[model samples]
Target: MEEKVYIQLKKKITVEHNHLIKLDHIAFVTGNVPYLEQVKNIKIYQITEQDKNVSVIDGFHLLDTLMVSYPKLAFDLIGPNQVIIEVKKQERKANIFIILFIWLLLCVGSAMAIMNFHYDVSMQEVHQSLSLYLTGRETEKPLWIQIPYSIGLGVGMILFFNHIFKKRFNEEPSPLEVEMFNYQQDLDQYLIHHENVLLKNKND
Candidate 1:
């Protein structure tokens, strides 16, 4: 009778979860009979009359462990190992001042363009009408100076508000995401190991 053999190959596993969940553990059945012996520090077991199964025992815990111990290796194995990481979306606080400032700038810029195109009137006249009582002969600043100063102030305000907006909104990922990604990576490696074993058996 032909000898029966089972080969061990790596398997691939994938994990999925919302931003709120984290990976815990994964388990799977193997075609090979559980080995009751250890060889060269490895757990060796026969899968069939002619084939065997060997766990890369030393490396099982080394999956996502790369992120902390070996970041480069972690990145390399992430995609190929069939790991899936999903980060939960976090609700960030909105900056009211930033929103208002942006709206004001947009309105002012649009008004300036519209006024320049349609009014056909001097800026001095517009200022006088807008500040009739304030611009009475008591004012020391000339209309030319006031106009440029106002424009400069508006530009400065816009730049300042934009800086604040970026500071508030460009937040880093929460700790949960990092943990979940690492957990998923580990699951992927285990699956990959099992898949490799199955393939090896087919070829043999």
Candidate 2:
């Protein structure tokens, strides 16, 4: 037999400015069942029932409450897990692109250096032959200036492409979507606990 589940809101309050303020709230769905039969059932029930008074307006409410109650904590519980996941994914892709860009710059720079060296040698040979036939000398550019110039040009091009890619592809999650994602996770966990409790009760 399929049993019905109930949704409940739990609220926790803390004293702020000498007045009681709702610290955090969690919305959980659970079925009425005996606590002893199911392991962790009591704890889940206590977590939900204890916070029943605080209204959960959005997923971030839980994290906001935690942040408000615990000032020293660094992580924001209000943000959706999906947002964190997406941001991490975006960063990974950006890093990969950055690495590829660097590799391409190195390959192109190496090819250009080889070509320039060959061209310089060819020009030198022509100049030597011409100078031998005439009463003139050949002028050569310094290697130090040429090498730095080529490197600077390659670096500048890579930077420009990186900037363009960031502008075109980089995206951050919106506040609402993050909240929704968090809410969904909480709701699912709550329902699962409730179902398990009901199932245990039915078996008993």
Candidate 3:
């Protein structure tokens, strides 16, 4: 009886440049087959300097290559039909000056946005009117009401984001985080589709 060789192809694999793309790097190849080590180390492709940063490898192509060398072995392949090999981009070290600059910019921008909104809606006049009704006095500035409202507005923002600096107030993801996660998922799917189309067009 032919020995069973299980192969679980990965959906996506990220790696560095200038490396031999091996079966072991892309999939999980297992089962007590003789020359299993050889099967796992099969040189499926190479990420050369000349090659593009992204490449797609189909499972069918991999299977055909394996059968040529080990026709006697039984293969059980699982997972997605194609695998994406992408070169991981190196990230630059964080600079404190850049971070501080961004922080200041955002702070100034946010304050200006809030002030514009308040001005548009005549918030100060509304507050003055409400203060006159409650305190039975015509006041130019409602510091008691405005101070609490300003503090509450800042607190509300923190609560909405569910984060304060690097610390998270809750386990649930914030709205911004959820949006970013969705964007990443969409990007991955697009990469798969785009790469597959390129391969098909090349074959044609």
Candidate 4:
């Protein structure tokens, strides 16, 4: 089946902030011309996947003043792809008290774990011994070797998990994302198999 084009704004818009006005908010459009005119804020996009047609033009009636008088102009400018309309969305505010409470708990828990581990086995002494064994002589602070190794650890993790740094990291899923996609695919297959088994049992 031919893939139906999908279009959506990169970010959710909020009228209070006028975030839609920013050009960066637009994901991708088939054409450059703004199909819908706006006083300040709006975005256009074209999706590659096939889905149910979602017409945003209906919402344009609300902003009839901003829309072009001639409907032909939209057809000439924007292609057949259904344009996803961006509009102000009502959302709940984050609870700072809850956030602070969780953050405090995590910090305290991590600190206690680290302290307990250090008490059981002195990491500083271990580092000194390892450094002496490797280098023949140990420096006052093992930070010289530890710092670079720690930095390398983070770099290695990024390289392993996310390979493409400069190019699109979103359009192309990461390794973990690919694994998740495969897992979901397998789950769907199992669900279909189970449903078939249930139907066979009913028939019997």
lDDT of each: 0.40, 0.41, 0.84, 0.46
Give TM-scores for every candidate, taking all chains together and pairing residue i with residue i: 0.20, 0.18, 0.80, 0.34
C-alpha lDDT of residue 136 in model 4 = 94
Determine which window of 10 residues in candidate 2 has minimal summed lDDT: 81-90
Give lDDT tens digits, candidate 2, residues 153-185: 767765544444335323554454478889977
Please report the TM-score between candidate 4 and the true structure. Answer: 0.34
Compared with the true structure, the alpha-carbon lDDT of candidate 1 equals: 0.40
Report the candidate with higher lDDT, 1 versus 2. Answer: 2
The C-alpha stretches of model 4 lying farther than 4 A from their native spots are 1-127, 133-135, 163-173, 197-204
TM-score of 1: 0.20
RMSD of each: 18.2, 17.5, 3.0, 14.3
What tens digits encode model 4's per-residue C-alpha lDDT throughout 1-204? 322222333322222322323223333323334433331234322221221221132222322322443333332222222223234345668799999999999979966886788668877788888899998996678897778965786677677777645654355667887899899657544443442221333367
- Which runs in model 2 stand beyond 4 Å of their true positions? 1-138, 163-204
lDDT of 1 by residue, 1-204 (tens): 322212222232222222121122121212222331211123221233222222222123323232343243212122122222222234467799999999999999978885685357575555555565655553433565566866886677655444444353335544554678889767666645653432444357
- lDDT, model 3, position 78: 87
10 residues in a row with least lDDT, candidate 3: 193-202
